[model samples]
Target chain A: MAKTVDAKHIISITVENKPGVLARISGLFSSRGFNIDSLAVGETEEPTLSRMTIVVKGDEATLEQIRKQLGKIIDVVKVQDFSGLDFVERDLALLKVNAPAAKRGEILQIVEVFRGKIVDVGQRHLMIELSGPEAKIEAMIALMQPYGIKEVARTGRIAMVRGVK
Target chain B: MSKKSKTSKPVERGREPKTGSQILVDALIAEGAQVIFGIPGGALIDVFDALYDAPLRFILTRHEQGAAHAADGYARATGRVGVCMATSGPGATNLVTGIATANFDSVPIVAITGQVPTNLIGNDAFQEADITGICRPITKHSFLVKDVKELARVIKEAFYIASTGRPGPVLVDLPRDVSRAVCEGNPSSEISLRGYKPVYEGNIKQIRLAAKVINDASRPVIYAGGGVIISGASEQLRALAKKAHIPATTTLMALGAFPEDHPLSLGMLGMHGTAYANHAVMESDLIIAIGARFDDRITGKVDAFAPHAKILHIDIDPASISKNIRVDVPVVGDAKNILENLIPLVEPAEHKEWLKTIAKWKKDRPLTYSDTGLKPQYIVEQICEATKGEAIIATEVGQNQMWAAQFFTFTRPRSIITSGGLGTMGYGFPACIGAQVGCPDKIVFDIAGDGSIQMNIQELATAVNNQLPVNVAILNNGYLGMVRQWQELFFKKRYSHTTLTGSPDFSKVAQAYGAEGRLIEKKEDVRPALEEAVASPRTFVLDFHIDPEENVFPMVPAGEALDKMIDGLA
Candidate 1:
């Protein structure tokens, strides 16, 4: 009767802005065999503190274990699990697609429908930047996959609680 | 001009400018550091120079590894944040194993390593290694101080982090330039870190709930670990166990947390644990785990471990709760404080039937080994008798460790120190040196195997020079006893590379270092040798030639259930 499949979990951690703090956090995760699906880190309102939003794939017990382990890190100030809460998640991705003269018009049309922007243009390709939920980014990437995608770079998911205080 | 002179004079009077090295020394002293273990090298000359005038005493170890282990031992024995220092490159790298040992065992140790100059750090200068990076995984926290102004603060923070919240080793890498740089500030005695806070009080609700469970259960057992000693909760734990009339078992790291002579004591539980303790755990309805992590060695076949029990885990580190084995009630706090709160709430209860069952199991398969020749267990039992369960015993890993843990009856906290989690060989001798230094009035013994004794044999010189009357009892079996036993049982007696046939005569080696040495080959000489070593005022080494084929019993093979322990030799 044990659960066989892992569920997705989003955990946010606030930590001090010290060198190698990120490495310490990631090292703990890897050593404990917790798979980090998506990770995004940035400075919070306080310049000395950084917030890390990590999406991990694990069972409920695994997530709880991860939360406890994360809290044990001395540099980590707080750990909050937002997977079961109302949270707004976003991911930013840039795609370099093979946009020949023929496909340029079609790519632009698709970009318009997806609310994307053309950030850079090259001789053989056009770079498109998109920011939205992980699903929307994945949809955009899937649509551009047929157009011979040249390259892709993504700033993994970041999340915050969505509510009016 | 008079006003300017007055302002400058006030500034000079208020705070004296000192070099970073001097400030570091002052900071350590302010943090109440009494002794440090280390060896000086080129990069740390300035710091050593400053230490020359400092009030703290430094034990010059033969190697940096010895220094690190000694510091770990000092911390384990005294409950103080032990300090160690080493120079850059090889000196720093040599501390890696010892740091990992301390980290795994949760010993509070602050390891300070010298680094190359800040400008020359990445330039691959002579005797430079990225120690901060190297020790990051092994240490609780690490610092590479780029600015001399932060030297004192970093040292203070290192001590704080090392000693608090499941204490472990912390490394502070001081660059040569930073150590030599002049800084204009006095060391701060106050520490206020926003991120680092350890929970010391257990939730009353959880404690009450745990008490209710303990009261309701027909069969209950208490499992204690090293945290009981670290938090100084031995008395509280004993009081709780005695009040509840529940049998208690301690892990290897917690050997002395509960007195073995106590009637309620089930001794140690787990792989090499007592048969009765393991059986009690397997059959218990309520398991109270205090400051103990359910490590793999303790909980074999996690799914089958204590299947009928509702575990109540109490520990200071929240991470250790339900990390390996899931628990029903988790209390995160200092063991002493939590037990103090819990003992009052837990009503007196009796499990006469449960105790009877455990007692029957204990009487049925007691810890025993067949005596064909001079057995290591026999020697350990004799040592225990000689010390009257008072000497602090430190042990290296392998068969000797298991035998000591099994045979030696520990009656006080911090009396038995071993590398439990890391299982590092060569840990005992140097650690005994630290233990002797930490507790100058107590007799300290290092129960070592021949193979393990040779790992840090050079420390005999340090022990002799320091005049630390550390008695080392080498269980000489002419083979790496534990590995050979494993090979014999699991590898069809392959015996590949396990023989240490031509090992140096330990007695002669001890004499060469200006210490007393005795080689006891006969069984009758065991007590006399031990007595002589104990009575001697100087360092001594007794090589007890034990049975070569003897093996530690009551071992639960890896991945097997605790109750499925293989009892004694066929």
Candidate 2:
């Protein structure tokens, strides 16, 4: 019988760095109807290879299907699903908040609590840079919402096993 | 295995700086291509010029779609990678349906499409289309060769990717400049792709587990698919069934994987399948699915399909397992290798009671049709008798395809070729041409429909030009019969423009193309017409006027369970 385990999943994929690789991978996700909450891709330590971290929501069957489907792509070298593993994930976000001098102290304190850096300061805004797990990043975004955040840019989740092999 | 090994290392040749077109021809010759199906266009003029001096015979098809299907047919018939070519824009786009058809059925074919020059690629030049992008999702892999230096290697890689693993169509997009540029034609002899290794050996533990399940089950059925034929595992599949005393049911794609004449055979299963086969699957306790994906057409209602059975899916593509139906024992590897390993481990035992139940079901509701008028089924049966079930039968989709699948008995692998997944019309005639070209000694027949035959009717010229002697049996119902069947059953018989009132006389059309033609309206004429067509030296088209309203029986309506078949209005 098909297994039914629905939850968030982080899939780490290693693929050869080639033209249209990203398009092919993303096309596969869209074509298969898999829900991708977040996705991050970049060159790995080896220039010839690239790694992708995709955060998706699906049942065990869906995840397994996704993994198998991903593995079928000719350029995909390896697929690692961190579903039940000790893993560390990080998401970096840069938010430009409406920092009128009146609420400057409050925003700075909240940024300090999240260990975020104020990279830029203008007359009306403070650009804050924060990097952490997705939850932490989301929490910070929520705390800064009341301060009228102007623009936000986020690098989607990137993950690795907690321990070295 | 008398054919030269596809993976054999290339022979050393004197190094020569040649144009990319010359390299492409050399690569095809080295890859052991006997023929190419294609049309020439402005973008591919250089390649055509190079092919002029090459040994490969290029069969110029009227349409790019025909070229692709012909190549697919050749591949399916000969167990070799079929090749086709097209130009940019409309020509490349035309091959989409055929390429998708081959892809869905896992037929190994390589489509070479010439593109506008590299500088004009993104500039919206005339007759320019992003073919690689268009075929990306359908093809196993696609390459856009930007440089002449990579042409030979890309061609080699395209062929390798197409024929390996779960074989499917591959596309190579060559820019006009790339084909014209000079390069050292030292094609890569060794193909080493770190990311593209396909596992051939199944896990022994899983095989043993599957064996134990088979041994423990009171009833087991072997569900075979096209992969068995693709992997040439019919012998192994037959042995396993015989040794284990298990009943075998094939999918439409795997019509010839197991001989239908065998007592253990249940014919095809699932939608429009044999009633006995569906009943057996629903009642079986174990299903040994080999080289078959549980497609929705087979599953009917996925949740309730084979509810009482534990499925053991053995396929080369791991994704195919549990993608639709959950598999209990999933073995990922080549089906042939897994079956070879599994045959010995499985214990032999005949469930006398179970077999008796299946036999009763078969007797109770065997495939039945009226012996009146010029029935398409009777024509198919006659064709089978005439060829002794040995003809390479290719079919166009719809009622004609279903009729051929039901009535004709296939006794060997690669004997039946049809568009199963994409369900493309106009596939049969060109496919027959390819099959006849690939296997000249064997008779090839295309069972086509009136609506579908016209789609690629122009290919009669190609067939006559090549003197293929391919036979076409047009089940001329004068309508899109399959759709009309659905309309009759569900849509209040509105017809919905399904009639083909203005269609040309196929016989005269065939004669116009310099081939023999006959119109048979009587049952007595069917056998004689078939005999005459088969004996003809040139290509022959036989238009058999069949019943327009005949519907395929034992059909599981959309979203219904397999067992809940509507067996022809009660």
Candidate 3:
């Protein structure tokens, strides 16, 4: 069987801030076998509404299906697929990596180049915060891997479409 | 707040104080709800109290499942949102199957379940269940009403959401405290939800393109489904088919959308579909799917289904268009609107060669069975003849359902109700009661298999008590007929637990329920038994001892193409 090539898609949905709405949305994705690469949700400007940014990997047809299915949910206010749009995408990562006094200088140099900040410091580790596009975050993590990374916590990608168009 | 003012005007527009339950009743009545089928429970006592003097008529069903299926039947019969209600916990849980059944078949029904008090909701109070959460997947939408002010709006929204676009079941969980609370204000009648706008008009470009495809195809077939009935597009579908001179096939849900007796009608197409219909679909150069999702049963072996055809799918739900089978053109809108738009652009063309080929196939392999002792097919055929094909026939899932779909010639929309998507057993009897209730003057019959009927047979009392003249024709083969058929073919006749040798006599059961009952074992008794049931002023059950070894023919084993149907008892 010939398979359609899968592509990464960033979909944002605004929904009513009610219990079980998240379960309904996420359940639909999981039920249809659509893999969620990353998901981030928070309250929108309207206190009664919540916005969810979901990154999924699927073919164009499958993504279109997901978008339409999402639109069908009563609580979902709007679903926008930013896969084909020029958007500002960002991911925030908190890395607690092992950094001795000698290695701390090397890690600091890499963090400085990536525009990261040291949020906390321990006797044997430094917790660095990095905020950027997924690619930049990936690069920063890769460079910090040699410093004997101990722990990593990352917020999934969130996106906003560029200016009025 | 004066006592004199309250006493003088009990229900003054905005001055009188009404309980939350009163507002709920008023909201339902305002939404054009004629009747509700449900059972009362502890959590729903206040709602029932409010309903006691309300304008609505409530049919207290024996079981919550019966209430739900009855409501589903009402919705399918009338094309209106059917309403069913029950209290929390077991009462609410019993409605789950019926809700799923309605959901699977896209029947518009609003199920209102009573919950524990607002503060006690998460604590799992007596008779409490997280019904909204439990019903999330099965409902089009669900609401947990905590505040009295939101009750009216939520009810209105539930009706709106259930009846729009691709219709399905919606649930509203009303907490006991909310229903009992007193609200001084009038419930709002208006609904403004930003997220729920359904597109009803097809794209002009796509409509035109579809018309062109229809006009140019050499072997075009119009495959219609339940959406045609939901959108009331049967007339438009017939017009398009007639104008384009195209043969049409309907799914199980779309049985009556196209006249089965028409020259262009291919009775049904799929697993239990007619041989000619399946063959026509297989050989067609173009398939214009109007409102029909290419369900797995309809499109046997998706990759090989209509392999030679260029598909055009028109439906109200955009999600259903290319969800199953790939299509060359997709039209997302109401079926009626799209069909109306496409009919004008369609050019009249005669497919003489194509029609000739289909006619030959029809003549070569007609749906037939040998005249044997009390055959189920014979009973279904007799019923069709006796009713003149006008009776509202609901069937339990299995051989009986297949036989009804195959043997009965349906001529009008909403005439045949069966669980198509869910293939649920125990759906027919309660649904029969609902259909009879909705269409009081129409003759209703539940063509049931012995095994399937027993699943919800207790509803016989509900039918009898309501004085509904519902005729239940049980095809008793002493086994779960369809599963047994599969066992015979695939499981080397092991039979397993398919046999129901100890099953009670359905006729006796009907008699026990204070309804008319008859047992027939001979072929000659079929017509008279049916005639007797039809003429009876009360509910009747006619149990026919059909041949145990019989099977639904023209079987296309799962995962095989339509053309590869294994015909006959081989």
Candidate 4:
């Protein structure tokens, strides 16, 4: 029960797109001793507001507190934790793999298997773009490790409830 | 000018365009502000100039910190939004401790800080500081007003944020250029923040669950804190306790929220709290905690605190619920509102056995001190007796604060003002001045330690200049008594740097500030000095030389269980 309660949790927050809003949210987390696993924020469909997705690992109690504390900030409009909810989650990752001429075909085959796209090809590296769940991204990264991965940039998790209004 | 030139700006309703500073002043007046405790600097010269003819009374505090604390004290005493003003950089930095002090205790205050001109903001111009950023963590909310047109709306938002749910300090940093610029728009009176609405009503289902728990419990205790006073829920709390026949214990912040003289009153609970209160909490089957977070001071060892209790916590801040203690039932809303709803659902019960047990414990280990010499506790009792428990008492942190809390039977909400959460020294005098200003008809006293008093002792000049007639009772023990006590008990009496053998005469210091002073080395002179100081029309300091080796009784050493207290009776 404790282990289940204490696990990776993803929280989505909608806030007014004003100056210092990010600073306020980030500052609250730091002051409360909450460590963020990943954070992604951008302007929403409404130009006046921004949506933030924060992935953090904490117990149920701590998560509740984080949700409540986040709700307390004046700039934060709404907080929703996608726990035990039917949602479609996606994260984008760009991986620069060391694609040797001898192994280029093998990397391409692996990319095709994962439904990924080869966006940029350098003399010795291939920048592959993949959009999937975090676990799938991690699995791809694991498979690319033997092929000598150079660097990776990942956009943190973003999710939408299925069949929402 | 003679012909009303067409090139001039158009008048709005026969009124000329107001400067940003004038708009700020007008906004404050519109918000119903009566006084502003502040200091003027170069960046704030325009605001000060505007304030010169403004209807609001400006208090010139000796330091920015004093101004902040005075504002906090005024807010705590009167339940109104207290306002303080200071310049940029160092002036704003000086208000940090006082701001944090108010923030920790959830006092409603608006701190207005002057900034360098907009163009010079990030250039590290003279007296420039990122005050909004500096105060971000300490304040409930903060704003840096760059445009003069937004000044009125920002001020409205700042006040609204500061005085609303779970009230706390808010900061507004105004650039010098903004202050000087013309604001053509009318000062905004309405505030609409999409993200700032507070939940005032508790969920009916949760309230019913809490009331059911209260009705079923055989040994229940009501633990109340500052929220009771802030929400004006003391009457509701008292009614519930009487109806349920459950004993009640208050935190230091909740001292005056529940009358200590009431039969079911457990006085105070936690470190240096009443023996019966601690015992009752530890043995309670149900703990209906209202407006009070289970601070470490109250729950000594997290796992060992109230080991047998099923906790029901009520508060306005949702984060505060179950943050420290795992609450069984949580009702997140205003205390008064929640209590009003819960009171009707609660059924009456006697709990004769529980009350008898608490009564026996109270009788067995009542708060006591050796009445032989000039004890600080004795001095506190004398002051309480002199005031008939009606004076608004402010206290600096340490032994004196604990003694005051222990001795005084606080019967009214907002009557006892002390730095509970932050425990900041040098907070009392300025707070006392603010309290006196807020409640002019009532007597206000600052019970202070010799060490803590000196931290912000310069506030005497502010009090004297304003003719506040506030009294200060200095419990002079020639050392940092609380630290010395810890050393005596825990550190084998190393005594380190706690001693102040050559401290200046406080009475003489008071006299230097053009206020009356009296030195009392004997217990016989304690009451007389208090009377004289209370009667004096000017600010007065009563320096009472007390026992150097005295320690606060019923102390649960840090990290020890609540019941593991150290005292002669224990």
Q: For every candidate, how close is chain A to the native chain A in TM-score?
A: 0.95, 0.96, 0.95, 0.95
DockQ of candidate model 4: 0.65
CA displacement after TM-score superposition, residue A141 of candidate 1 (Å)? 2.1
Top-DockQ structure, candidate number: 2
Clashing pairs in 1: none
User: What does the TM-score come to for chain B in model 2?
Assistant: 0.97
**Candidate 2 — which residues are off by over 4 angstroms?**
A1-5, B1-13, B184-189
In model 3, the runs with Cα more than 4 Å from the true position are: B1-14
lDDT by candidate, in order shown: 0.92, 0.92, 0.91, 0.92
In terms of lDDT, the best-performing candidate is: 4
State the lDDT at A78 in candidate 4.
94
As a whole number from 0 to 100, the lDDT of residue B480 in candidate 1 is: 93
Candidate 1 regions off by >4 Å?
Answer: A1-4, A122-124, B1-9, B12-14, B185-189
Off by over 4 Å in 4: A1-5, B1-11, B186-189
Tell me the number of clashing residue pairs for each predicted model. 0, 0, 0, 0
Clashing pairs in 2: none
**Fnat of the models, one by one?**
0.64, 0.79, 0.61, 0.79
Interface Cα RMSD, each model: 2.2, 1.2, 2.0, 2.0
Classify candidate 2 by CAPRI docking class: medium
Question: Between candidates 1 and 4, which one is better according to lDDT?
Answer: 4
> Per-residue lDDT for B122-212 in model 4, tens only?
8989988898888889999999998998888889888889998999999999999999998654545567689998989999999999999
